[model samples]
Target chain A: MEIAQIATIASKEFWDRIRNRWVLAVALVFTAFALVIAYFGAAQQGAVGFRSIDLTIASLVSLVIYLIPLIALVLGFDAIVGERERGSLDLLLSMPITRLELLLGKYFGLAAALAFSTIAGFGLVAIVLSAKLDLNALYHYFGFMLSSVLLGCAFLSLAVMLSVFAADRTRASGLAIATWFFFVLVFDLLLLGALVVTGGQWGGEIFPYLLLANPADVFRILNIFSLDDVRTLYGLATVFPRALADPWLLGLVMLAWIVVPLGIASWRFRK
Target chain B: MASSLPPNDAGAPLIVAQGVRKHYGNIRAVDGVDLDIRSGELFGLIGHNGAGKSTLFKMMLGLTPTTAGDIRIDGALVTGRDFRAVRRTVGYLPENVVLYDNLTGLETLWFFARLKGVSPAEAGPTLERVGLAHAAKRRVREYSKGMRQRLGFAQALLGKPRILFLDEPTTGLDPEAIRSFYATLRQLRSEGVTTVITSHILAEIQERVDRIAIMAAGKVQARGTVQDLREQVDLPLWFSVRVSKEDFEAVRAALSHLQVEAIEAHDDHVKVRCRREAKMAVIEALARLDGRVRDLTVREPSLEDVFFGFSD
Candidate 1:
């Protein structure tokens, strides 16, 4: 594919978000929420000062699991379907660019916006807490930021895929919300309910593998498994085997979450 | 104005479609149609809504795939691997062209110009060419419908494309803007740019286009110059002969022996209708009246009349 054509479309999407302050607004939201959870995470136990980095990250993970996917889906659900509904798809398709280039460009551009906001918003918290922690704590914080970006990218890819398959913006949006509800809220509950109803005898061996099916759970494991204090505190270390907790493996799974949906979007858009 | 061009057969065919067909289930949007559009020619494609003119236009631009046949631009397949090169030389203005409302008029042109690999610097002059220079810095959301149409025309004029495909381009423009729009088209024609336009306003393009294609029921019913189509349909011609109230019967009596179809008298003029071949004979009969016929004018079938005759 021609990179120049891709860049042209990507830059438009990127600048549209930048100029409208969408990135800034999201970044501010991230920074505010992270700082609050960092300082006030142990308030229920009568603590108010900046807590341990492990506890801060654990609290932040809960917030991000629900927030990032929703932001990504809202950002990208209308990328293609909106153009079709507004009657501009014909003009854009008439250009010299290929359908693959347009799809990739749109994905990369919005991904950049989401990544930038996630990094800036949470990275600011990392700086404020750096004086209280050691290098290992800073490493974990940076890892948290990176994984958050990947999670957003994965959800954004799904949003774009829905945009291509949907006939109009209204339907695309409905599909996006339904996707959010499935991955972020219902997937894990259904798995847990199955395990409980079966009394742990039916899905004990496959339960950890099934957790990888949801990117939100994957993000949770990726962050929570790396910290020893929080790993025992969250108690998920019992069910999830140490062999599957490799940071690189979980990162690859997250990358798959981003790539597979984008690939499907590209294929469907070309048709 | 279209008469200023060279003969119809002068230029080679720049766009060729061969038995192209697009079928959606049982509906034949474009069915086995073949057409050739010559370079430096202003061609018009006129048809009723849902007659498949837009579908055919999309196929020619490679925006929609043809299910059965092929469309080639400049000897290259429109949907081939090398279509990027073909697309660079073409510009299109879709019907009811929609642009981003958040961008300024100049920014809209720049966005398209960059996509076409043209320099963003060209956006200024392109907007000026379409009479949108005054609103270059204003957001498109603030523009009126006529202004938006002009901006869409400006976007199509970017990159100096060799061919232009305009679909109902003058939809919301006033009469003055429509004149200016066609004037710009005439200027482009002199530079050897082939234009294929579709318009519901047949009268607006009858005198401007070099050749016309009338489509109906997913097929081209007639294709030729306006005069050629008029003759092809064999529609009647009319003559308005000015005569005094007293000489009305005398004027009618002059053509009584001829094969005139109908004769009706108003206050001071007699309207005579006849076949295309009887034009000269009827005129000669009126000439025999000498000063009795003070004035005489012949009216051929209009483009709308011809459109209805073919499309209906």
Candidate 2:
């Protein structure tokens, strides 16, 4: 709602996190991750070399969807609490800016940082795919990056919310990490179990609704956006057709996760 | 800086509160109270532990909503909505002034400056003025407590606020830092800034503040100038006279000449305080007597007396 304040905070957050060792170190770590994906995607020059597209796309998809959100949580879980503990919040309040400004600033900062990391890390994926192969997967690769970014934003918003509401930064960080684990590592298992209990009947209709709650669903849909050219193959060959069925609707739903949680956090910050 | 605020009958003061309260569950911190702070006056809030000075400050700052009554600034009522706007004009420094650990002093300064819409070039001079220009390039993590305090001051002073709030600004500071901090406050006062400082150390704000409010049981028990607070108590003044060992007996014998109210004889001096207005007359009367006066000090009742009297 407050534009100028949000821009200022966003710029500061972006620049400040850029200098954070944890954030910067993760970027380097992601750079290495990009290389690993490229190697696995293309190293099979002779043995089962189903072309470099398969392995690289799979690796980039997995890293972008799963790993990036975790990185976001790691970075943002202390956005507010860290300032409060350090007593900077008190000083910040004394300034001419409002708490809403502070909230929007912090969110924008984290988002900007994520954008940088996403661009650089996934740009590397695009680079490798473009150079090492026919450079055909560039378009799909960005789709993965864009979807991953939107999903990551939702996770970052949740992290910031936890940071503000929890009693302390340590507890906030712990809760943020736990939430990430539930979505990334455990939710899929829970979904599969639910589908199994219904004897595969649940997988068709009701399971998709269940998937919406998990932040991973957004990433899945975005990844489907990257594979638009091969929708027919996905239906015939891959297990990812669930997201491919109607990607646009899924994209909007994923975006809602980002906007809604952050909206609540801005409200809570004022409170 | 010695200017009086809005005259004595200048309508409602800039900040007024009636029966303001804050209750954090069982701990009903700030009970019902009334406060009136005139514009441009340095008002000090003094209290013992659990007296709720900080709680009141938080309520006023809109960090926490008040349980009851009203808090206003510049005639604008502080509903939850106006917190951001009100905060812009109110600068605050907490007891423990910590800053962004990873940011350089300059970096942190610029960050706040940017928030206030100040350019880095404009902020540079302020960093220097706070005596941290040389240290600006250094990370705040490497800064000393005093340095951080100054940095916090710089941040708080960014907008040249109308109302400034500080909670125990002298906690970790050394004597020199304390003095400079006061000097800075004095400068702000000269700039017509209204400051409300909460501190347990009465002596710290004893001379600088225009008025002080002493809080107990979550409400202001007494509020006035140091001289006025002294009047509220059963304060009788005291005079201390120091002389050579041989002159002790003579001064004791001459105590009757001054018609003194009470006398407590120390090893080297005699202390006297009377209801009579003529403290100088006693000294003059002592010179005419057999007493040999080496030194004399007339004692005014300390802030401790005022605070402790209310404590009881």
Candidate 3:
């Protein structure tokens, strides 16, 4: 693999987002939402002000779980298929670069864009609340920002995978939306319904392990398990074993979510 | 001018395809075919929409895998490990070439130059070479169709590649741009760049390309110089003779002694159609009429006629 070739394509994709203000727009959205949730999250409970960092991160996690995946999917759903449909794929393939290199370049470029926006958007919030929070609170907020970036990368990987396998942009987009619905909305609910219908008799032992199957859940667990207050508030501390909640282990699972889909996309694109 | 001599006079074959084939399940996009393109030669591939010219072009560039056989460029298999090195020395301009609409003309060239491992600084001069330097900073979305085509050509000229593959290169160019495009091609030829071009406009490339390949029904029906193809097909030639209306019969009688195909008289001239072998004899017969033949113009078969002769 030529690093130069990959870097060239990656830089082009990254700068395209930068020049078009896609990165700026996404960062602004994240900042606006994070600030609102940080200051007004407890309003329904008859309290509104600068809340505890733990409670703020918990609310932000729920928002990111829905927002990042959708942004990532939209950002990357057209990576390969768009080139193919626009008739640029032939010219790009005709270059000296390999298909694997091109695929990796595209993935890394868009991943960088999504990661940048996630960091900038939420990092601004961390600064705003830094004076009120202690060192421990700052560390948890930093962890939340990191996990949010990973979730975006994972979903971007899936979107690129769909771009390669899909016949056109329309189909790739449809597959992307379907992927978001399944992972962000339906995966955990189906696991819960399976357990309840079986009266806890079926798949109970593997329930916590199955949560790792969804990157969104992994992101949620990664952020929630690190904070003591948020961990109990979600009631996941009882069913999700303490041993399996290691932040390092959950982080590795998130990395796998990012890598595996890209691996499949590279394979399909080579064919 | 290269057609005047034998094709081998140019150099050894730089690109060779041996029984190359590509099948899309039931459809044979490129049937078994053999071809050789010599170094520094301008070659043309012409055919109808579904004649598989594009498929064969793609296979030659390794953009599409061949179902069977092998294609080698400068002795390196297009599908093999050394293809990256081979590709580095090759340039391609795809048909209806599409570039990033969001990029400036200069940025577009730099993007391709980086991919080809060339210096981004070359983008300016390359854009100037294609007459696109004036619009270097303008986004491609604002360029006209002809300007986009020029930018695409500029991208292909990066890295000073030794070989070029152009597909329907003049699709949207004006007469002046078309003239300059071929002029640049001629300059590249002098630098020993072997170019293989495909065109739907037969007349546009007939006089420009050194040799031509006519494809039909997924096969190369004929391949050679224009003159060579005309001779192979053995189409008839036309001779228009200008004479007084009263001497029309006399002009016909002069050529009647020879094996002339047909002779018809118009208001100002008479048209004579005859076989290729009978050309010199017919000319001699017409020359014998001397004073009666006020003027004589010999018209050989056109490239279109030769194309239809073989493709049909």
Q: Which ranges in model 3 have alpha carbons more than 4 Å from their true place?
A: B1-10, B241-258, B262-270, B284-296
Q: What's model 1's TM-score? A: 0.95
| Residue-by-residue lDDT tens digits, candidate 1, B199-281 | 99998999999999999888889999999999899999989988999998888788889889999989989999999888998
Instruction: Compute each candidate's TM-score over C-alphas.
Output: 0.95, 0.86, 0.95
| Candidate order, TM-score descending | 1, 3, 2
Each prediction's total of clashing residue pairs, residues at least 3 apart in sequence or on different chains, is 0, 6, 0
iRMS, candidate 3, in Å: value is 0.6
- Kindly report the fnat of each predicted structure, to 2 decimals: 0.92, 0.74, 0.92
Q: DockQ of every model listed?
A: 0.87, 0.51, 0.85
TM-score of chain B of each: 0.93, 0.87, 0.93
Pairs that collide in candidate 3 are none
Cα lDDT for residue B184, model 2?
Answer: 81
RMSD of each: 3.4, 4.2, 3.6
Model 3, A122: alpha-carbon shift in Å?
0.4
> What tens digits encode model 3's per-residue C-alpha lDDT throughout B102-215?
999999998999998888998999999999899999999999999999998889889888889999999899999999999999999998889999998888999999999999
- Please give, as one word, the docking class of candidate 2: medium
